[model samples]
Target: MPAHVPDLTALTLLVAVARTTSLAEAARELDLSVQAASARIRSVERRLGAPVLQRGRQGRRSSRLTARGALLVEWAGPVLDAARDLDAAVTALRPPQPDADPVVLAVAPTVAEHLLPGWLVHLRAGPGGEVALLGGDATLDDPAGDPAGAVRDGAAAVGVVETGTALAGLHATTVATDDLVLVVSPGHPWAGGPGVDAAELAATPQITRRPGGGARGALADALAEAVPGVAPAAPVCELATDAAVRAAVRADAGPAVLPRLAVAADLATGALTEVAVHGLQTRREFRAVWPEGTSLRGTARDLLRIATGGRLR
Candidate 1:
């Protein structure tokens, strides 16, 4: 091994660029200026003797990782994981700080926004008192496809994900159930009317969550089974958060299929109306997950108990 190794800071920046596919965006995240990010990237490329990013056209779009960059990112993932673990291990050796916050949770957008606030209140008022929630993306920004990954990577003590099956490396306990409802603005024709035909609903383009989201995946699977060989139109717009999708639908961008819990307030306020789909089943399971074989203790155990209503699976 060379005495001079590539700086982890630069490697971290590379991974950020790969995930975001934008030099400026990655730089912003790393708290570095664009010029500094570019310089760091060039330095890394020189060290590796290969370009890591394919810059997009100026003023047009963002840059993306090249094939070599993808490989570099793959190599960097484990390095970063190890670094995080090392930091955690060191932190664990310190004396416990009485004022340290409660266990962190990683949760889906719907759970974070609609369910957690009330749940936390209940938890605090009960056996688990005055618990603090951290890292659930409560603002509905930067939603994670697998919140359980946060638990697996030790970033969170537990995760609440909307899925029937347990994610690999985690044990899941069913906590709640949610239905995905087709919603439209009050002025839309579907509002206060008979249910939409399954075929028509499948054919219509609507505002939706980005691909690979649990809600989007559930809807896609239902449509596939309901109308085989018929594909739904591409979404009118794909938003990352339920809140964003709701906003788009409220603006009359198009009808949307969303978790009922996410739009409960809007439905009550008449800001949105549910349009039943005759033959589509939109119900989904919500589960609390923790890393397999790990015994829950203290706040984590208390949280799981509260989330599952004292039912353990």
Candidate 2:
């Protein structure tokens, strides 16, 4: 380790002086004041203990490289070329940065509550990059607060929702599956016996989620397919959240259909009973969605990957 190695600026200034044949001209080309460029040369000479320039007869304005300066210029050529190469390599190797603004994630209630926490934890611990996420309810962008609509409208960069239906104007992929089960308090009559028929279930007034919710929409679609021309019976109660619906059902409000993920513990502990529904398909898909034309990258892509359990799509 030498005490005073000439820096890149000094070396570059020397090369420029060699090419321009005048210290003032080289300084001008490099956007440095003549005094500053002269100081750089002096600094280099002090470090190297050698003269690197020859002053011409023209009032010390014109310059020429000394024997040592000519050798230095030749040596500095490769070093300078390598420096340029190193700079370009560094620029090429650098990763493209994600948008500075936090990526907005709109999520449906069930997925947001039951699944998002773990996914976000994984995202934080994983290798992708910084996860600057702003999480919100699926309704963030749309007046209706529909996750699909929020994504399509560009209100959110990504969305996680539970649904079995196709979303127009958006690209979606299944991340998980949930069964919408008909559940009641342990004391309800449906808790003990034979499965209810699809038609009978459709006609029974039950506690349910609000119309726009995923479970409610999925249940409606399934019932419509199972019993065509007969609309579902109006709800005895319409709740805004899964917890509310579950609490109401636990208190014997009415039998309500809900995602099993929301009530699995209650079902296992016999706090609630899952009544069978004959001829009805309650299986629904939980999906990650984004606007059709856009490609997910950076943290957005990383979140999608984690949600899909490490599968990159």
Candidate 3:
């Protein structure tokens, strides 16, 4: 016998083979393919240092259990029975159904306005109570409205943020990605022109989000990396939200870097034009973050699953 006993799966497969007297039938009963079942038995035999089944010279048709295999099957019966009992006990101890607690979601403005609404629609179509939504500019200058901060402070059960900053003390997973584009009104001088380079963009005064917002920070970082030793010029106008900044840009306030999702409609409708910025990359990730040391249960986990298209658990 192996020092460590074979796992439950191997033992169960052996028992199935003995009961059915056909390896192929045993695999079908266990929902395993024939090849997988064969490999599993081979693994068990290697661990036991003996053959479990004797195959006829013809093929799998005349296979039979070896004497050692018969003995293992007998010993494995009690173990499998005990495992079933343990499973029943554990199932009884668990809650009968999923928890139905109210879920609160704190979301960044861009994600809330652009991506989260559709996610919420799908979430609401299923089993859940009213989900309190807190959406705003989660900037360093404004912690009160910071989505990640809300999760860290226990004010919200989950948060969605789009930023390059590492969220300390929270478990974060990427759900989607977005790019920021420089946009100007169709009537602006730079509109429909051959895009500007990073240095030119860095030196130009334009409408921007108020200092410390995620989009502003992303643009600044990209510009700094593209043009070393250079900082972005002061904004001609600084606004607190992407919507306000977009409105300003639409009114010919000046060129502003904004999320593509936020401007896709306006660009499609000819209300705004996207200006290409050469040598400047502004792609950012959208993340679902929750407090560390706490597993997401109930509706919170459901919402995350929806946001990630059922990928995360």
Q: Show model 2 residue runs off by greater than 4 Å.
A: 1-100, 127-144, 161-170, 291-294
Q: Per-residue lDDT for 201 in model 3?
A: 95
Lowest-lDDT window of 10 residues in candidate 2? 132-141
Global CA lDDT of candidate 2, please?
Answer: 0.77
lDDT of 3 by residue, 115-154 (tens): 7656665665675434656532334456336788889888
Of 1 and 2, the candidate ranking higher by TM-score: 2
- Ranking according to TM-score, highest score first: 2, 3, 1
The lDDT for every candidate, in the order shown, is: 0.77, 0.77, 0.79
Error of 3 at 119 (Å): 1.9
The top-ranked prediction according to lDDT is 3
lDDT of 3: 0.79
Between candidates 1 and 3, the lDDT winner: 3
lDDT of 2 by residue, 1-313 (tens): 3676688888999999999888989999889999999899988878878778876667363468889888888888866765664443333224436654556777776676566656665665575344322333235233235677667777778877677678888889999888888999999998898979899999999998777764787788889999999988889987777888899999998999888888997898898999999999988788889988888998889878888877856
Which stretches in model 1 have alpha-carbon errors above 4 Å?
1-101, 126-143, 166-169, 212-214
lDDT of 3 at 291: 88
Least accurate 10 contiguous residues by lDDT in model 3: 88-97
Model 1 whole-model lDDT (C-alpha atoms): 0.77
RMSD of each: 16.8, 22.5, 18.9
